[model samples]
Target: MNILYIVGEFPKLSQTFILNQITGLIDAGHHVTVLAKKSESNHKIHEDVSKYHLLDHVIYYDENGRDSKFFKGLTFIKSIFSFGYSQLLHKNHPIHLSWKVLLSSPNLILLYNRLKKEPLLDIDVVHAHFGPNGLLAHRLIQMGLIRGQLFTTFHGYDMLRFIKQKGDDVYTDLFQSKTVLLPISNFWKRKLEGMGANPARTIVHHMGIDVDKFEYHPIKMSQDIKIMSIARFVEKKGLIYGIQAVSKLIKKGYNITYSMIGGGPLEKEFRSMISNEGLEDHIRLLGWKTQEQVIEIMKESHVVLLPSVTSHDGDMEGIPVILMEAMAMGKIVVSTYHSGIPELIEHGVNGFLVEERNVDELVHTLADIFSLEDSISISKQARETVLNQYNIDKLNRRLIDTFERKTH
Candidate 1:
């Protein structure tokens, strides 16, 4: 099957889940063409991006005219000439697009230009990664610029924070037009249903980690504990709380080292807070490591800590893939019972889960893991959880089957 993946950023360091899906599908004998709004940061990308040569199959467009309007106009005119005005205009257009939808054409003028040269009308599925991308794809389909069964996956911010800001009706058109709605967690599957998504069309499909890539090694008890977090420095991550918890533990005379991987808007503020708290020596903020680097870090660390919490604006995590990766690596994980995290982590079973912002509880959980005799057993259970449920190859095959069934 030929699938076109619509996304906000192509080959992003943070969105390895999407990349995994793309490459997984390709490996499973499907053609995937990526359509991204923009190429993301220059930070080192996942090795799979190069290994799979994914950039070759990508089509990029400017979101807000970071490129000149004159160039876009030229591209649009060129597309019209190449495809012929009648074909591009669609003489018997399938849907009646609104003025607002027509207005969004310029953002996709470059894509239209590519379509003129190599039209994707034969594509079986047009799957968008987020709500906004789904809306964009809906507009294109409405304009008769693309022809495929539409599907959208609603991840954390797109459904929670975005809808909170844009209102419940934000996804009304997409919900009505899309053939399927995939939410990464049951938490979000309910949210989509509440926001008017058809219950029949919605499916809870988790973003999975490639368990094979993350080689599992039983965690060993050590005097000097190494705690690590691999997440964007954002409000919802509650990284500041992690820092505070680590500081409290240090003051209480725990021999521990904390390492933070990934970078975001809150980096400067986090750095300042770490300096002010005099934890520069104990906590290391290593910004934006590649996928390979992260796996290596996970292998060395005793416990993975992700103190995720609901941000002020209601942004939250939808079961972070990093936790899945750590669990797959047979590392004990300590995260919060926020959003869909509890679904992945069972408190005192496979892994430990504390309340959202309870630093003391987080400290206690970390301390317990350090001293517990059955730490290795718990870590093995963590790996078992990932292998049983969150395995990428299995999830991707399920996704492909769903796509085939829905499109047919």
Candidate 2:
């Protein structure tokens, strides 16, 4: 089968679940192409899959890659203006918040057109990752160039409030959706169904982790009971609250160390919190490290926490892949029962789940892990869940099955 894959971005440091899916599909002997968002970040996309070598089989396109930086900057400015104009409709414009959301179809049309030619996009199907990104690809198909089926996975943010604030109506224009992969919890899927996705086309496919990458065999085990979380230091991740909880844990002299990976707008604030809380030694903010760094931290740490909460702007985590990665690596996980998190974690069985933004619950969970002996057993259970359910083989098969059926 031929598939054209679209995504917002593919960071070079580490391969996200989309990449894993691409890798798996390509390995299964499917022809594929990737249309990705071009960003100013310095991460490289790993084209190591055998499919990438088979140029006819797999390829990736970055929408902004061909445009000049000056033109891109001007387009960004115009988007901000458009966002402000849309704001006359609402008191607060969540659209105007991030400058990156300014990247739009008009700016990327040429790139998509070029893709239509090279990938011969009329292949069997074109699958996009997020709503807007997928919708952009869908528009290209409507342009009469790419003769193929168009479907997009409504990941998070796009449908969650990010696209809504920009005045993009979710109710209008249906693409030829063969599937809408919602990795989020069932609760999130129910909300999407309420909003207007076809129930028949909707799918609950969790981004599976590569069990080969994370297992019970200790790799980088640190002696101290440590906690690690890899998320953008943003409001939705509950970083601010997580920081407070970690500080509270310190006050109790629990002899714990915490590490926060990934970089974002909240780095300075998180650092400030650590300083004010006098946790310089206990807390480490390892900003934007590579995949290797994350795995190292995950292996060495005793547990990982994903304290996600709905932000003021309605932004929330859509079933973080980081939690799956940690759990896959045989590390105990403590995530909140918010959004679709509970779908992955069953409290007291594999890992523990707490209330969203509950610092007390987070602290208590950590204390519980610290109090247990042969802690590896808990880690073993966490790894078992990932191996059994979140394995890439099963996920890829489900995805391929959907694509083959839908595109045909």
Candidate 3:
């Protein structure tokens, strides 16, 4: 089956799940194309991106328009006049044109010109990653610009803060037009249903990690425990709390080193906090590592700490893939009981969980893992958990099956 994925940005470091899914589908002998609003980051891209030659299959709408802006403008004007003339000729007949259709005419004109110049492949499924992308696909389809079965996946911000700001009616058109509404976690599935999404059409499909790439190695206990967090320095990640917790532990004369990997808006603030607390020696902020680098760092570290919390804007995680990557590497993880984290982690079984922003509990959990006799067992269990539930090969098969089934 031919699949076209619509996303806000292509080749992003943060949304590796999309890349994994695209590559997994291609490996399974399915043709997939990516249609993104923009391309991002001059930094190194994922290895699979080059291995599969994914850039060849990607279509950036803005980039295409930039090539012949004058021609596109002329075409846009011509299309509007042509459409208006047709409407006038059919004014005697009952013509139903909704406000949405009128509002989307400008974009439709641009899409019409783009398609005339370079047509897209025949698409069996139009899979959109976020709510806004789904809305864009709906508009294009409504204007007869594309043909496919619409499938929308709701991630963290799109379902939470986006809904809070735009209200429930924001997705009313998408919910009506979509063939399926996929949420990465059960928590999000329920939220979508509450917002009037058809329950039968809503499925909880997790974004998985490539387990083979992240080889499992039993964590060896060390006197100086290295705790690493591979997340953006954002409020929802609760990196500030992790820093404070580690600082308190360092004050108690514990031999611990905390390293944060990933860059974001909070980098300056985090650096200031680290300097103000005089944790320059114990804490290091290593910004943005590649997928290969992350695995190597995990091998050197004994624990992965991701203290995720619900942000002020209601943005939260939908079972972070980084946690799965750490678990797949046979590393003990300490994260919060927020969003869909509990679904992946069983307290004291596979990994440890603490209340969101609970510095005392986070510090306590880290101390417990440091001294626990059954640390090896916990690490093994964590690896097993990911292998069983969050493996990319297994999850991608399930996703393909869902896509193959016709949606009424």
Ranking by lDDT: 1, 3, 2
Tens digits of per-residue lDDT for model 2 on 1-408? 878776655534434677778778888998777655653275533444333653344334443365677765665565446445655245354322223322544444344435535535457877777777666665556444455777667657776785666564543455234445443457756866766677776777777866786655433333466888888878888878778877887788767788988878989988888988789999998777666567777767777887888888887767788888887777777888777778788898778888887788788877776777566666677778888888888888888887777765
What does candidate 1's lDDT look like per residue over 269-349, in tens digits?
A: 999988998989999999888888888887889989899999998888888999999999888888998989999999888
Off by over 4 Å in 3: 64-113, 116-121
Residue 49 of model 3 has an lDDT of: 88
Question: lDDT value for candidate 1?
Answer: 0.84
Clashes of each: 0, 2, 0
lDDT of 3: 0.83
Q: Under the 3 Å rule for N, CA and C atoms, how many clashes does model 1 have?
A: 0
Please give me the total number of clashing residue pairs in predicted model 2: 2
Q: Write the per-residue lDDT of candidate 3 for residues 293-329, one digit (tens) a residue.
A: 8888888898899999999888999899999999998
Measured against the true structure, the TM-scores of the candidates, in listed sequence, are: 0.91, 0.82, 0.91
Q: Hey, what RMSD does candidate 1 come out at?
A: 3.2
Residue 134 CA error for candidate 1 (Å)? 0.8
TM-score of the candidate numbered 2? 0.82
